[model samples]
Target: MIVTKNEAPANISKAIGQENVTPAWARAVTSFPPSDRILSTILTRQAERYGERILLVAGEARWTFAQTAAIAAASAQALIDAGIKPGDRVALMCSNRPEFLQVYLGCAWLGAIAVPINTALRGFQLSHIFRNSRPALLVVEAQFASAIESVEAGVELPPRTWIIGAAAGASDARLSAVALPARGAAAPAGAVRPGDTVAILYTSGTTGPAKGVCCPQAQLFWWGIYSARALGIREGDVLFTTLPLFHTNALNAFYQALLNGCTYVLESKFSASGFWAAARRHDATVGYLLGAMASMLLAQPQSAEDSTHRLRVALGGGVPPQIHGPFRERFGVPLVDGYGSTETNFVFAGRIPPDRPGTMGYLADGIEARIVDENDSALPDGEAGELVLRAGEPFAFATGYFGMPEKTVEAWRNLWFHSGDRVVRDPGGHYRFIDRMKDSIRRRGENVSSWEVEQTIQSHPAVAACAIYPLPSELGEDEVAAAILLEPGQSLDPVDVIRHCEGQIAYFAIPRYVRILSQMPLTENGKIKKGVLRDAGVTADTWDREAAGVKVRR
Candidate 1:
């Protein structure tokens, strides 16, 4: 029953196409009927059909579908025994480990909500999530437990709490031991329905502040269907993920593979050097990547061993337009870029196709995506406008942000959710991302897109990384400013950087000033904190501007 690329089951594509289906772009347009089922439905199906097949791998431990389900059920019973009721939130603060999935499925099995916290968050950021989620319990690894304990002291929480892998240490005694029940009567025989809230995944805190985006179980299922088809994840597909599970990219991708009954491999942390080794070890046919991760990998010296891995697809988000062709050429794998957020799951995903540089594929089936002006009027194709998505089919649409009615209302305004990201639809109906609402520069009656500027600057050999934002000008308005990171041993002259931009970018779009930085400030999810950079003010002291050929012109 090995489900290889050539031997995929006949019903695989059909089952995935049950939703709002579009044949043109190859995707499901709508969500299926609400099911009174947990994520375990996929697990149980695997155990019944593909028995004894490995479902999960972490470190040296391997778990079959049956064993994994049993552990999940047992853990669910443990939560119920510890007074966790249905809909109660439980935060999972652990790295990429077997226990993370075990605890996540355990929560789903019991109809409780699982909030996976980013492990990279510490201090204030961690406290904000703890307070926002207000989880009744926390299932944390021993290493992060201490950080949780320190944060827990000040934050107000639910009456009960629990931590995994830690028996009882003097650090946080209030965290009681909830002994996992041994194969107890299977979760009272009920399941979390499609519309019921399943989890509260927080948004990347790049703009203002992080707000919890509510997602339901059904959304997961629908997106899982789309993802499985788009990425071609099959029953025996070995999928590897090193991205933090807290992000929607990892969570959806991981669950999509699980729903496909694919073998999943988890790494505690991502390492550029060891990535290929791990993929080869697991025989991974598919994996996940972020644009930043891809850029980092491409920066490393190439080796003959690069193309030897079994990875056929790397489904991910944020693959920059400039690097798309080069990355695919170097890696020999098609990079399928998907567009989504915590509030709305995978609205549009680029499916598996021959290498097409800089395209994020056509709009996903059943999804009604459009570019609209500030007045909410639809703009003509190729005009930059705010991206809006209407749920063409039912899947996991959020109940709304937790306790933030104003924010929720604003987000879901005009019967269309404002994505805050700008985009343009091409002649063939393909969408190209422009810049975030906050990142687009308004200068001298002209709109300058930062993405276009960054792409141009990135073409330079010494430009390793770059961020473009609006800077205050003497004209009483803001103009484009650039911050760049240089390659090792490479020195940059500001004039040369500006001159390079003049040739590639439009006159108005070219940066008025170029700032060289040791590194760009990044969010936990690796997106640049452009707002922070703007607030800090791009001053001469912050950038290394060699005084040669630099000039100020009106």
Candidate 2:
């Protein structure tokens, strides 16, 4: 539902207030030493103050704040020593691990720009990013080193620049050529500021080739502050991250943990069986999730083990607030809804209890958001329009997409960054997501929201997940087409699904074609890959469970 600018959202302040339960120490730290420090500065400070405290825990290895800082400093010095000057780009390809954090912080320390590539990408897709960023240096893992080696054979990188992790084997010549030091040394004489560009994170390649988002160091530093405040992170909190390091969610989580003087627990990836166990092992108070992560956890038939987690918060983005209550009630943990993108970081977030079902929570303090139509006219409350936001808080926005000046200009047109997302505003100033502007389906001169259709179709008892799209109709126009995933052991009967949708949705909104799949194609981040589905065409050639005309109700 679209919200008007003046309309009040349902009473959701209670939920917002509950999430603001910040600890005393975190609040004290924010006030005591009010200095503008980069992430590297925060790490160095923690090294001095909490030298013995475990700053990072991954696999069987652990690094204290002092040790982590020393390694990062040495690594930074090694890059500088290798002719990697300030502002050079460094691409990182590794799973979620301590080395990833080291690379992130180490790059910051050296004033080089970090470009973390998604570990899941392969061949041409990976090559595209490498070519786009044109990094002077690449810090890769042994497992993915071969992919880099293959790319290196064809594309030459700048001299004195390839650094591989321990996985490269102890005797490898390339590893020695780019070996990082084991101790700290004085950084080269140069001034690093918060306003300097620190990293260029590529957007998830769901729509097309990803664009590099240029985030200023000062903005990123401030992001740590706003995120910490919004999520209620604390000094003693253990932030658990299973999301890929290449993604903004994990990197932001790591930065937030460091700023709060908290311990960060790293998991190579997300697994339902090991999720809670890992949290308990590290005494983690907070965890991160995407909507698919929650659904995957929910799909794993209920067990008493489900309620055994020690997590105080499972905060992240894309979770439909519809499942928020059930997810919390089932796991005995609160799900904090936050919204951000590679282009914009943490623009809005939702708090704990009293969170209205389906709402994206309230706008973060100091951030301003509005619903504007295609003509850039601001819409009143209850109307759905393109969501635009301006930063009121520090590190709240991105400078632009690197090397794409036109794209950057387009994104930040009229002063506010265009999120390209359709959203509704409540009278209370909170925004509820409707759908992506590109994700909406147009049929019969009417707009059909895929998310609204997907939500209603998913209510079917036999359906596990659904992806709705627009397809060519006999009427020489587009019509709705839906691909559904069945609940385990449940079979898909197109006729039954049509009957179920008959009264639940409008006739125009109902899908004309229903295809069942073992699974829906998804992006690395688990968002439904509608483009892939669209390419597959509307009607199923085979594997169909119903006849051509499967109409049920009018």
Give the RMSD in angstroms, all C-alphas superposed, for model 2: 11.5
Tens digits of lDDT, candidate 1, 1-554:
10001112234345334333332113222222346334656556546765677878887779887787777777788778877888899888777777777778788877898988766454445677878888988777777666655453668744554555655442665555442234465565335676777788765433334578888777777677667767766566888988777767667766666566678787877788888888888899988876556767787788898888899888756665566677778888878877777777676656455344455555655567768899878888778888887776565556688767888898888877888888887665567777668556755434456776787688889989999887664332466778888999998877777777643434556677677889889999999888987877758554323244454321
User: What is the lDDT for 287 in model 2?
Assistant: 87
lDDT score at residue 314, model 2, on the 0-100 scale: 79
Model 1: CA > 4 A from native:
1-33, 149-154, 170-185, 205-208, 354-356, 439-539, 543-554
All candidates: TM-score: 0.74, 0.74
Taking the tens digit of each residue's C-alpha lDDT, what string does model 2 give over 1-554? 22222222233322335344555334534643434456566677767877888878888778888887777777788677767878999888777767777777778887899998766444344566777888887777766665544342355443443444652232323333344345457564235766677889876322344578988775665566657665666677898988777877778776776667788887988897778778877888888877557766776778887878678887746655566777888998787776776677676766655356445767765567779999888888888899987876555578888887878898899988888889887776677887667665645433455765676688888999998886654332356788888999998677777666654444556787778889889999998888888777854442222346555443
Using alpha carbons, what is the TM-score of model 2?
Answer: 0.74
User: How badly does each model clash, as a count of residue pairs?
Assistant: 6, 21
Overall lDDT per candidate, in order of appearance: 0.68, 0.69
Judged by lDDT, which candidate is best?
Answer: 2
* Worst 10-residue lDDT window, candidate 1: 1-10
